[model samples]
Target chain A: MKPHTLSVLVENRPGVLSRVTGLFSRRGFNIESLAVGTCEEPGMSRITIVVIGDDAKVEQVMTQLHKLIDVIKVSDLSENERVERELALIKVNAEPGTSRAEILQIASIFRALIVDVGSKSVILEVTGDTEKIDALEKLLRQYGVKELVRTGKIGILRGSKSVPGSK
Target chain B: MKPGAKILVESLPREGTEIIFGYPGGVVLPIYDELYDSSLRHILVRHEQAAAHAADGYARASGRVGVCLATSGPGACNLVTGIATAYMDSAPIVAITGQVPTNLLGNDAFQESDITGITMPITKHNYLVKSAADISRVVQEAFYIAGTGRKGPVLIDIPKDVSTGLAEDTPLPEKVTLRGYNPTYKGHKRQIDKAVELIVHAERPLIYAGGGVIASNASAELVSLATLVGIPVTTTLMGIGCIPCDHPLNLGMLGMHGTEYANFAVMESDLLIAIGARFDDRVTGKIDTFAPHAKIVHIDIDPAEIGKNKRIDVPIVGDVKAVLQDMLSGLKKNNAYEPWLKKIKHWKQHHPLRVKDDGRLHPQYIVRALSELVKGEAVIVSEVGQNQMWTAQHFCFHHPRTWITSGGLGTMGYGFPAAMGAHFARPDVPVFDIAGDGSIQMNIQEMSTVAANKIPVKVAILNNMYLGMVRQWQELFFDRRYSFTELPPVDFVKIANAYGIDGMRVDSPDDVVPALKASLDCNGPVVMDFRIEREENVFPMVPAGAAINEMIGGHPRS
Candidate 1:
């Protein structure tokens, strides 16, 4: 199944997240990644979700999302020209000498920040599109990665277009 | 200024509610106290489940939003089945549940429950009121949401403290505006034109109407469209009364336990116009082969239901009445379907719905007798299973809203309380609850509520000493290993008398009509127990997952 990004705006209310996620689970729709936060408008939240399905299945997902009372708008951004990014923090083991130097150089090449430097490990904070983050993580795997955390993909329309219901 | 409880009590009348079916508990005392002085009449049901079913019954019968109330935790939980029943059937209802004090909400307070979370899946929408000030707006919104779009139950959970707290005495809002919930009322013009094009050229078009027709009050439009186009009509259980059973073009109920002729018509039709009915599994057995030769035109208010089960050639998403009216305006009178009509007539004449006569009482005879006695004008409600199928198959319904049953959820204990609710909605009309022995015992406690109110609801129990439907299935599919389908005999007449209501038992076939007449003539609630054939099976059955044309019995030629 291809991953399709959907940007949804909903009324900021208690249990709204559960309602959306609950619908996905019950309807057996697969969700690849999801991120939720307040949008530009007050009393509204934007949920960016990466869903895996074919065209017909994705159409059904959009239609079902529209049925939820709290959801304000749903737009599929996969086909539109958009700017997308995901942030990931990777903590890796760093030896004292040459290995430490190599890790620092790799971080610099990827433009990742050395957020925390400990005696045995360093936490590298990376922000980029999903593929870029994946590439950096792949190279750092040789350095003995300790841990990794990611904020799932978030997107916005490029140029003058803004997601509807967000003023 | 006004207390939340008073505002809540006052809001009902403002929303045009004259009565509510409810059971009170500790958490709801403040609201009940306010209700004591209010003009709204409250019927105290014996159980919370009965309260919800009765409210649902009221909504279906009157075409209004029925209301029910219960305490938190167990009380709210008990209303789950009834709420799901209404949800599945798309009946409009507002359930008011009392929650524990806001401070104790999540601490597992003695009677606290996360009711809003529990009902989120079944309800159209729900609210857990956090402030006393939100009560008025929540009530107004709940009613509006429940009664609009694809109507279903909406619940409001008010904490006990919120009920006692004071808020500004604002007047009720004149209009409700929900940004995410505007329903499409008019069908897309292009789609309507396409549907008309298909209807115009179709040689064998069949109209498959369902609950949406009754919900939208579109029976007249449906009849007019069918008559003008000269298309034969068949109905789902919920669509039984949309076209009079005796109408020249009516083909009776379709699906499992449906008529043989109706199934035959569906198999041969070239165009299937589905109005306001979802393609439920029971209605569309073996979906791949259902109406195999027909191009489907599905019209429904809920967009989610349009392509949910069956693919549609012309999808018209709008209110049924509005869409039918649009189609009616674009159509011309056509009587070119004489060949198709003749074929259907042959099927109807050859394979009529029939039951064996062993010189013993049959449930079908009792239902037919009741229909004749009432002259097809009674408000007939039914419990689920064999009794429900028998009533739907045999009884002649000439008008909408006259036949109410638990079609979607198939809750067994639905009818008795629902019949009481129907009685309250239209006291002038004769109301009957045709029930099975096993199903009637589920909510038989409601007898006290009916007897106390002196409602003249007539109950006909087709006692077979078994869960007849399950037994039939076991006999057909399980090699006759009855298991627990057999139920111990209970004297229902004695139980009715214990509750201080008139009771009678009829064992002879000749006494069916006279017994029904006596029940109808009674001034108060009466229960008539008919000892029917214990092994009687409902015929013209379509085995689950089989095509509609694959029948087990009731084929005259076979």
Candidate 2:
């Protein structure tokens, strides 16, 4: 399956996300990763979607997206030069005398920040691809990880032509 | 300035009306007089409650804001039920009320009431239009807001001053901008990837579609994906029309009233792809146990709905059509083996939906006959109770947007008025409301909405003399101690006649076709009260707080 990214511009409205997600859901599509944020314009948002399908299917979806009244533009940014980032925050137990220094060293290697330091626990914030976050989380679990929170991924296409279908 | 009794008039066409379903009384003569001369048709209802139901019907059916007009005091108060009904269903309808003159506003005035406050909780927004200039804009904004975003009803209370005051603003055409009201249409890419990876690896995939498909007009996209990936499809009751029932992959409706095969499929599936649907309790019998083995990929337009019901493995938030398109782009057609499909097909044939045979007239029989008679082509609206469940069970919906019902709110007295609204939305197709006696009585006054509007909506009332769903429960759990479930019935034929509507009460199976045809043939509204046995029950009910498959059959009670 070819990985495709679509940059969609849409009107910023209440329940808009629900409406969009509802569209995918009703059609039984599995959305791999999605992110939404305010665009350069006011009252508008850029939704970066990464999906896996053939070129023809992606183009078909783009056409339908173009038809939506609120949808300003939809472009498959997969070929576009783009930057992607994912953030994950994980907490791990640091026993009084056992490998606390080693944990901090591991965090340092990953450029992760130790955001919280309690006598029994240490919370680290990590930013990377999904695999990097998953590996770090898994490695930290050996020390009795207490809690974890990861924001759903977000993405942006490289350069500034704006998404093709975004209004 | 004319006398305080000036007969104010407002003419309108049927293109874009917000609200107009209510009864006008003594002091509302001026507004009613204006209505009489106007092309804007007015529905004079037996009760104000029916007016709101009619408006809600219109809103849900049309996807446009519905308009219902009523007069002051008791008339306005009666509209409260319909307003609340629309509010619960999140239907976009604007109710206009004719108030006593400005001078009589706060005098504890005869036939005067504070309708704005009464309808406040039941509306997304409400306005008391004071000046005539504000009338058109207010009406326009009410529609704009009501039809946009979440799609809910808004109320406008027009005082006599505004209705009669000679303000020269056109009755239509204006732009209203709201600062904090933008809805997002595009979905995020990263989330799409996470969802796709899960779907690719999933051995058992289930796609659950909700009413939002029809709302977004994403039925075609849904069908494409379902067919593309060979995913099995189950639907929330409101999600009925999203996919045609005849599709090979369809699992029928899912919920408390859903078919056994559908519930079983949902339970056994390995991956659940929930679209547009908010997993209501009725749909997910026991949330913890529902799709216990499946990884849920929840793609919804609403973010709040994601973690509210069932936890998700992949959450895709965007419009269903666009998201489906994106998801389809990611597909490699790995669904070669149809394990889930084969199993569900086996279940469908093995445990087909059946009615009890005791030489008694059953509501299921009526629904089945109706489904066959209509060829699953007509728009079907059902009131809540056994009738709603039976209709869901028996009706084979062939097209998307054809089956309209009050699913989320489960509002009774919803069928007839909604059928009227459906008829108005799809004028060429015939619309039918399969209602239970108790449910029908809740908004029976809409008989006038049908008669006055000359909408030929066929009404099939399953007159069982009891609230069927609740009674079935009583028999199942409470040992047949039927309490207030039994109702003193009214002669629907006489009631139909009083409202200038035609009706037939059928007790025998032979009369079913004739009654259905008669109702269909009548130019105006027609009611066929099927005097079905009072003890009939809708089967395959999920026991309270149990798993979906742990259903308690509707066994007869002594």
DockQ of each: 0.52, 0.02
Write out the backbone clash pairs for model 1: none
> In candidate 2, residue B258 scores what lDDT?
79
The sequence of per-residue lDDT tens digits that candidate 1 reaches over residues A34-124 is 9999989899999999988887778787888888899999899998999999999999999777488899999999999999999999999
Using lDDT as the measure, which candidate wins?
1
Q: Per-residue CA lDDT of candidate 2, range B1-558, in tens?
A: 321222223322323752366677765666676666566656666677777777777666667767777778888887887777776656778777778777787788888888876665566667766676666666667777677645677777777766667656454554566443445566789888888888777777888998777766788999888888888888888788778888988888887877788888888888898988887888888888999998888887655456666778888767878888898899877655477677778888777788666667787878888778778678888898888888888888988768777776678887887787777777888889999999888878778767877879888999988988889889988999998999887799999989898889899877877788777777778888899988877777888788888876732311
Q: What ranges in model 1 sit over 4 Å off?
A: B556-558
How high is the TM-score of chain A in each model?
A: 0.95, 0.85
DockQ result, candidate 1: 0.52
* Cα DockQ of the candidate 2 complex: 0.02
Q: What is the lDDT of residue B200 in candidate 2?
A: 79
Quote fnat for model 1. Answer: 0.50
The stretch of ten residues in a row with the least summed lDDT in candidate 1 chain B is B549-558
Candidate 1 chain A: worst-modelled 10 consecutive residues by lDDT: A158-167
Q: How many backbone clashes does candidate 1 have?
A: 0
